[model samples]
Target: MARQTSFIKLEGTIGDVTFYKGANGSFARQKGGVSRDKILNSPAFQRTRENLAEFARAAAAAQLLKGAFREITLRAKDLRTHNRLYAMAMSIIKSDLVSDRGMRQFNLGDMSLIEGFQFNINAGWNTTVYARYTIQNGASDITADFEDFVPAVKVSRPTGATHFRFFFSAAAINAEANTVESTYVASPEVEITSQVTSGFSFSIPKLVIPDTTQVYAMGIEYLQEVNGNLYDLNNKVHNSSKIFLVEQV
Candidate 1:
């Protein structure tokens, strides 16, 4: 009889929403600074978090278990490939937040208030990316329609072939247009994208609402197809994923 063996156990924080920490490092929660768990437990938050968590874990597992080689060598190229795959996974996670329908309930701070969202790709095949949105309104009155907004992302493959794609639901949309009109400063239509290597970013003009009236919630459906197959041994392929939300002003 053969014994079952697990190669790696997946566990870690996916997307966490916290309030803008002041100089003292304290903010509000339900209204302003909230704990990660609070945001995670919310029905809407849980849905997207769970889905994305499953997707990320599955993606990591697939890389380890689904490959054709059994006793695989961890060569430099292999590590590099894994790093690229991980980056794709992170991108998928971020995209999910933007397109998640449930996130619409929470008021995200003003985009202008947000200094910027930073993405860091490390050398050890580990990559971390996060966006900081300044929460002006203690809370948000608007909701997001995850389904309507589409994530316009572009990926460029460098070393070898990599597979990646994503989609959103109509549910993710701007709910509180009335609020944004009064609050924040509106910037000229800005476009963000990745370098030629393998990343891209672009804000949807129509989706950009007045930072005062409506909050911005974005969802992303992501897919990465390295070979002909989409998923891994778990019958999961890195395909369609989303992110939804409502931003505050």
Candidate 2:
């Protein structure tokens, strides 16, 4: 018999798996283990990190946009409320002055003597008059009216007078009696004793008129006196009075 020769296969093991040599005498296992540095620099790892970063940035931008939209919505609502309030006030003032029956008409221009009425201060007795209105859904609107009262007015007399007296009148019995004095008196009634040297004038405070049912035509009365307390007279002087009307929307 001729000499017989056989080749034994070599095996390699890694992680519980065995690799054997092939018919060509090449190892079935890979030549070398993967390096840590090469894995860290691989395109797959780099792409994954970049994807995570993009996600984070998108989330932050969404949050910022949401916050900005919320702020703008709130500001727009505030502006709308402010504009509505102003319109209501103006409308009430411009409305035709009529009696309960709507027969008689009182012109606003004739009633308001003082021009350019506005709010003076924020609070207290010296504060300017401001009207406020509130509305409820499916309900009647309510209005709160306000005005500054000038109690006494000063008038210059053309001549030197010793005594001065003032009287006011209204078309209808709309004038209310003085609450403190309980006397039937119109607005801006005054009596002065001092004489006029250069120019006679009476200081009067602004009149604050409350909403009343009797007011048809508002008027003012003026009276003057000279020399001693012997002469006495009463006169009705019709002057324009200003009333502010405010409505709630």
Candidate 3:
């Protein structure tokens, strides 16, 4: 591998060398590796084949988890959310002791590893929301409760921000079935300088399935009021969301 310093940037393949632009810049590397067919069938590449198979499974699990929380993630997520989720999924899948190296799956692994995961690292949930809260998972409903919360001192608002909203989401995920049933309930916009907020509760519906895993999340976003309308901040970096709980059944 080598960096490309030529006057005209080169991309694509030139004989055995391939050039491309990566996150760090443009570079060139030799396109010479074991053939796909050889790696799949050869005895020496058994380890490689096993690793590839396990990585594919991890990717699928990551996609399922990401899709389950799409509603909240779509509003607030970092640039590397997918990659981060994939890495986390790999860690969880590796904990499966029953499955072989190439056949590790998410269902048999520890599902609690995803708890406390933040969607946006720029604005973490703990740093953004200072007020304490509790969540209780019921048979058919998920509830979030907050004590006497003074937003002026408890909440951290971005510059020129006047209002904020909260999101409570619950999801039922089945990895083997590749299915997700999820829903969310959001709180009304409140001014940053509002008085004590008590008796605040969000009753979000939960999807109860026979063999599914349950996940819950809470999100907070800062907004600015313009002439009676609410607008998101410049880059949405101030928004934060987190997976508060995970129940594997």
Name the top lDDT candidate: 3
- Candidate 1's residue-wise lDDT over 128-238, tens digit each? 112222222223232221122112233222222233222211111222331222221111221223422222232332233343322232222123344454432121221
lDDT (C-alpha, whole model) for all candidates: 0.29, 0.28, 0.86
- How far residue 84's Cα lies from its native spot in candidate 3, in Å, is 1.1
Which 10 consecutive residues of model 2 have the lowest summed lDDT? Answer: 174-183
- State model 1's lDDT: 0.29
lDDT of 2 by residue, 75-192 (tens): 1222232333233223322343543222222222122321222111111111211212221212221122113222232332223322333221111111122121111223233343
Q: Give the worst 10-residue stretch by lDDT in candidate 1.
A: 68-77
The digit string of per-residue lDDT tens for model 3 on 1-249 reads: 999999888999999999999989899999888898999999999999999988998989999988998987877899988889998899889989899888888878888888988899988888999988777778878787888899988898888889888988888888779899888888888788868988877777777776989888889988888999899766578889999888876
Q: TM-scores across all candidates?
A: 0.20, 0.19, 0.85
For candidate 2, report its TM-score. 0.19
Better of 1 and 2 by lDDT: 1
Candidate 1 accuracy as TM-score: 0.20
